[model samples]
Target chain A: MTATLTPAPEKAPRRARASSGASRRRDSGPLERQQSRLFWPFVAPALLVYGLLFLAPIAYAAWTSLYRWDGMGEMEWQGLKNYWILWNDPNFASSIVNTLKILVIGGVITFLCSFLLTLVLREMRAKLFARSVLFFPNLVNAMVFGAVAGFLFSPDGPVNAVLGWVGVETPPKWLGTDNVFTLIMATLIWTATGYYTTIIMAAVDQIPPYLYEAAELEGASAWQRLRHVTIPLAWDVITVCAVLWTVSSVKVFELILLFGGSNAAEPPMQTWTTAVYVYASVFPTGSVPKLGLASAAALVSLVMVGLFTVLLRRLMRRDPIRY
Target chain B: MRGPKIVAAGVMAALALAACGGSPSENGSAEGGGKGEFTYWSMWRADEPQAKVIKAAIDRFQAETGTKVKVEWQGRDIKVKIGPAIAAGKAPDLWDNAADVVSTTVVTGQAADLSSVFDSQVPGEGKKVSELIDTKLVDTLPKDPSGSTKWLVPYELISTGWFYNAADKDLAEQPKTWDELIKLCDALKAKDKPCLASDGELMWENFLTLDLLLVRDNGAGTLAKIFEDKSGAGWDAPGVLESAKRMEQLVKGGYLIKGYDASKYPAQQTNWAQGKAAFLSNGSWVAAEVSTLVGPDWKMGALQIPPTKGGNTEVNVSLIGFSVPKKAENPEPAKRFISYFIKKDNLEKIATEAKNITPRADIPAPAELADVQKQLSSNPVRPVLDNLPREYNQKVLFPAFLEMWHGKISAQEFVAKAKEAHVQYWKTAG
Candidate 1:
């Protein structure tokens, strides 16, 4: 036992020597040169795939956005006129406004609710089970939610049926054309909060319990501990969640398209988002498709999401704290 | 170094293989691989009655002609996919849809001109297909966007009108004019029953009423002219304001069903079928769509949209039929199939089994469409909205009309908004 305790004194110098050897190897040429030599071999496959599948389509879209083509006809050189046309289009303007509303308003509400849920579930006995229950909505397809919401909010649907039973003579027109976009935003928040809360809960689980107990000993309230420790410690995950929400919100198409639950090819124009505008423009029901206009609209959305992601990352950037 | 070099070679080979992967299958599926085989993509789903009828016909045609047909039941979204397919030179040799949709293919120069098919005789029927079909419907077949070629060979016709439950003998007296129609609605309202039940969110369905009013008050092609006028000067046409005012009166007069503004498709139509409303302004196909809901109290009846001054009393018709793509590998087999498809025995299935109005005048219309067929025979037919571009109708006209119908604006305000929006629409259309 005495010899085992004394081995630490002998092990310290060996550890120091091992670290010095590692640093010496880093200072030398062989390891770095080997990594450089292997770099292309390791990266070339992924680079080729990414360039072909992702960047190439984006480039093609940008190129086509300049010409007025009907997908099967002669290409007319419209240059920047397509963009100018979109700028003047009132419907396209409405789509852009709707996209931004989903990004900002929907994002804020989702994150706030997710954080609150995460905080509550952190102390729960069945935290794992509770987290799973909260995340169940994400597992369900969005189309189901749209169809169910359409049924629930119909004038004589079950929601109103319940209201009637409760003696509420006049229920709000929940599926009214003016109310559709707001309802869509609510559905999005409802579906998204659960997924994000689970992610935040996972991040919170990594936090050592001793920190909370230490804060408790220091007379810190739950809110103050969260404000000081939980947020900062989980800041990276929250940043990632923000980026995910921004991209998904801009691409919110199927929900808006199917919200009213009719087989009608197009939804009401009042509820169009940028993605819906792109789809409807490209594949209008009974008119010649507008490929050029649709390409421009799609690129506009891509650029918007890219900008949002970058801005979010920048704003949420913080130095990572070590354990 | 050797290991890295080998890995690089492997990566390049993999990329090269990946690039080559998309070519083989694409080339293999090329058309005209066999003279006896031709591909067809239908606008109907596999399980629909129309598809079943057509499939039975296809089997019969194959047995008789020794031609093999490979068919894909692409359903309605085929419109969205067909363009790309045509662009890629992977389109089916034969396809069918509503005439207006086929005209879109014609507009894109994808649909082959079928005048020869029209001149060709219906197999064993001893009559030119064109001669057998309704002349008015053929005359109104929508031309391409350039207004040159006719592409659609119509087999079925669907017309727009006011549908009612004919079981009520008192409702048998159809209104002959706009005023009488309003009086009928007013009487129904007095009885605390709704007059007209429409799917307000369905722009095309609601558009039928406005288009009829516009065509009646002004003339045929007036709505088309309104869209074609790049300067938006056509909004100043008196018929435009008159039609707006009439629609406004329908809105303000409490004649429409409650919550009609928010009604999704088939909701109010169901209500109409149940006799909750006196009438529904809808397509003739409403009978077929709601056939399951028909009870003894409900007998489908249709009335021509009441005529107005200078309306020309023209009937609005939509033709659903077949077309051969310009890029088709075997146009002959497709053409042969189309002719066989229209044989008297074969074409009647559209009416008997599918519950639609057949394009052939020789075939009797379905019982539900007796009144529509009678009207079609008597009146000169015109394409829906005088063949207006659907985008213009959906975007510029629908917004103003919806606002008015929702009681958010008056007819005067409708005219103002429509004019302003019409001008804005054309400003950048170029």
Candidate 2:
């Protein structure tokens, strides 16, 4: 019995020796110094950039938000007065609601379309060609795409021409109608889905081939393998993308401005988003500059985006699976 | 990735070199020798005939005065580029823009008070802009209630009215009255043709029509009171309702081009130019655009909207100008340039090249601009959409007018909503 138990004692001594050696190295100044040297070199550039560009501007905006000054005039300290005005501003409220609608509705539509496309591509033998075709729209800039879409959707445009071919007699005004928000959402989805599908496909690719092989060996069906492996593996990236979409959709302006020529000015109240509202409010088309109010509005928008980001991240949180 | 990196490096190098010596400020200083160069911005490009004429004058002035001038030509979207520069404290000394944008510029305090410059220069320029530019139009500029000029100098005067295809000489010669215009529309319609083509998206054109109708029906004074004074009761006046009723009748009669409600500027103008429509209501700018659609040989003529019963004489002029930024690095040079540019000789050149009438009374009118001149020289010189308070012009008036054009809202409903919006704007603004 003593001889049998003594076989494990040899292994334990070797493990202890290895642990002691590791502890000694950790205690040595040279190893710690080397580790810090390697870490700082990697982090320095990123830290410098963040500090100079993002952090500095955000900090300045916060400071400026507390002042009551026209951008050109002398600064007057106003504490929370600007913020108070923003709370009371009806335009600000409308913008917030509009932005949320676009984000939620547009994001859902985009995600569904991209998700289905990704699955179809993943299953198909012509995946490479199909993926390339789907990704083509993403290569065009949003401004250029918005202009082209405007032409296509205009009253005497191709859409109407097609309707005429079918003898519809009267085609619905796609862009000129008061309910332009629907058109805007449709455009956002059309422009965004291709790029997002590609991203989702890449995420799906990361699901281990071994897992699929194992499932197949176990006689698991294609849908069953996808449910078990693909969804779970790619869920994290998809969630991150959703959060990014929320932020981007809220700030969408180029397309709206380009399509809605600066002076059309219909749908008076709801035509603007937070970004457009801030611009219009500060610039206030055909009015004086209200930079202080604009900055305050910007601060309010930042807070809104920050809160949503936090909530979304919390909603997306999950225990990591160790594959 | 390597290509991008190399390109970025080159850009950085270029930027650094630009920062050192190629900056406008440095170039300006060197060229002007401490007197400083004036940076002038205009919504006209070098490719525009107007720009070429103006540039020639600038070259002449520079040669004679030994003052260097730098101009930044802005395209159609003047505000987008100008607004950023203004916010960045890099605005030009002088900027040419429409009267509609004057209020915004003034509020920014970006415009310099040119009272002294005006007093000294404009009188001697032999144009007497104060007389040539309708006083009612000048009053439209953003100002303190106490009578302080804030932004803009009255520059290019434009007349807004109906432009008709000379190929359809019958419709062009007739329609001297509101009734005649309606009859003309009906006559065209009877022949299976559309009488009018309008860019529904351009709210100002619609607003211009309403203004013209008001002047034609009630008198110019009533029209002035409605816009210049916030007299809301005027909307209930017979002239206002009559104009609205006429517009509604036109809509119902199918006199407007098919799908005119959703048609774009180019499309509507193109229709008129192609002789598919008998009439296009727009400002003097149409001549240049129309030139592109129909050759110069296809005659185009401007005509004031036909008058209504008990109406005053119809008069229309485009209200446009240039302003000096208060924070401009070289205000003196800007003032000098404004004076120099608006001289009789320069104005004549601009009128000839642009194919539009100059506001200068002394400038010899170009033969090509005779059609526009005839329209401008008509009685009552009404300023198109210039008299509305800035807020109303932008927020309430334009949108409400657009709704009427879209046929989504009735004229009566538009008037009611517009009044409400105007009151609300004033309340908030006050």
Candidate 3:
């Protein structure tokens, strides 16, 4: 199973390592020798399940993508025509653009807020409380946040009420049609930052306080210590967080969908992500349900995730700094 | 590990090779005849009186025929559950559903033609089932242009209208003309209140208003042309523009509830129920949607869209019908049950107890919907929103209407843009 489905990232550096490390002699341990004998049966059940459940379906999708099929009917073979339709579809294009905006723009804002919070939270008296409060959003459903945002940002909602009480009377339209997508992004960043901050907080705690002390003794400012000692130490966790954020951003559907609290069966297409696009195409609300189009979109999304993950991993690769 | 992975890869590769040949999906159904326990999937919720009456009928059927007919009260998510089962060829024997059965179930070919059941007599009425129902409904379920089969059997009939609170000893302010309607809105505006509390987020509700506008300007037939016309050239006709101007006036004239576009579904309806707004444009079933909120003595009344300057009142009528799935396990019993259930006495129970309008001509509409029913009976009936193609309604058309509501585009711009979009759609369609 691993031979064909071995993730491209795993294969990539392995090929380069095998080629470059030709002179390095390896010694096999007794446990490694013992493990090789048991590997087949040990992996057999899991491999069977994964292949049948995960990879087989993906392969089936790849096959089905070349056809024009309504789920309960005959599939007319249309090799690459379905992909052409997807490319031409303004909704699909917007979904892709919306997805990237969320991934990159939302990612930047989230990391910025999370890093700042992590830094301030380290010295705060009620650090645990602050962290927990920040962490609470991830535990709550995104739809709940969406609903709350709808209530709080209505024309005469509390946000506007507070703004009116202050000097600035003209509060922006938070739930307006154009503003909703931006609101959804802001919500995503607001919710996601807390989770990442908690993670980075844990990673920061793992660093020996003595390093900070040493840097301080060497006439390093707080910023200097954070840059040289704190960040370098937390680099591995941050990279992991980056990959996690990227995947999560793509998977976002419910929050954007329920944003501004639409009672309509289908939300406006402006806020749709790739996942929503796949769902809307296959199990459509308005148009004919095209499983072929859905399958093709899914394959495209998978390829996107794969490409981004490879790029991220390659860029984040560094020498392990043993503390 | 390598074995399963390689096998998986090889299997997919083999499938890829086979993909070029175009394997046709086989159509098969277990609908030959009836045997064993029969299952039904009703879209009605269990708490509703429709469910109660259906259950009583089912009990009686089981008692008489000694056939176990299991009824499942599937909620609004009935379509969601039905979709996979339809694909897997495990469809239920009977489904009582669809606001528009033609485009949804009929074209998809999931619903079997039920013309054979029309002969079954209403149990005690001594009348044929077909004779009791509205022929418009009988004529409405789209059939194959080449075939004589009817795809759906019409059940309860629902009329669309405006809902208002009558708690203050009845509304003496029923507007019967466009001038009277505008005067009504202006009066409410003078009182610093919104007369019409409609949810613009859901385009169907908004379209109901637009439909009345279209039908009112010219006639039902003219509006139907706009819906049927593929090129969108007919959209710029006088009647449509008049309706768009009316919509523009409604939106730009400060008559709608503030933040109506931003409000969620049912919020506006709820606002009407709470007496926050003066009126809500909705269907006959509006009472049931907000049944829990209204008090025992709560008075709910609906008014048909008043006559336009030149056109007569055209009421939006819909047939809430049942269709036998092609893959039904027990078509015979399902047919018998539908016949038994549609009997005058049984259907009258739906009216008296459940507060619904039956397609059976003898049954009076529930008192709450008397005015709406009166209007529906008086006018030329059309399928809600002229039965516009669902694709255009949901994607292109609804969005255009939404943009206009959002104040992003003007009414003239809406028409021009829609015409352009329609032209683009035809090019794509070709």
Best model per lDDT: 1
- Per residue, candidate 2 scores C-alpha lDDT tens digits across B197-314 of 8766666666777777777777765654765445566667765877887777777778888767765446667777888887788776777766777765677666677767754765
lDDT digits (tens) for residues A234-268 of candidate 1: 98899888988887787788898888436645787
Q: Give the TM-score of chain B in candidate 3.
A: 0.85
Q: What DockQ would candidate 3 receive versus the native complex?
A: 0.25
* lDDT (tens digit, per residue) of candidate 3 on A131-203: 9999998898888887777668766678778998896666776666677889899889988999999999999
iRMSD value for model 1: 10.9
Model 2's i-RMS, to one decimal, reads: 8.7
**DockQ of candidate 2 relative to the true structure:** 0.18
Q: Each candidate's chain A: what TM-score?
A: 0.89, 0.81, 0.90
| Colliding residue pairs in candidate 1 | none
Poorly placed runs, candidate 2 (over 4 Å): A1-48, A63-70, A74-90, A213-226, A262-270, B1-37, B74-91, B107-110, B115-155, B217-242, B295-297, B328-330, B362-369, B387-391
Model 3, range B1-430, lDDT digits (tens) per residue? 1212232244334434444533222322233334645688987899988889888878887887787887789866676556555555666778877556334555566666777788778777788777877666555444543364466677678778878877643256678787788888898889888877866566677767777877788777665576568778788787788788888877888888877776556656777777767778777888778878866777778877787775567677877777787766577778888888887666788888888877776678877777776766667777776665565665567778878876678889888877776665554331
Please tell me which predicted candidate would have the highest DockQ against the true structure: 1
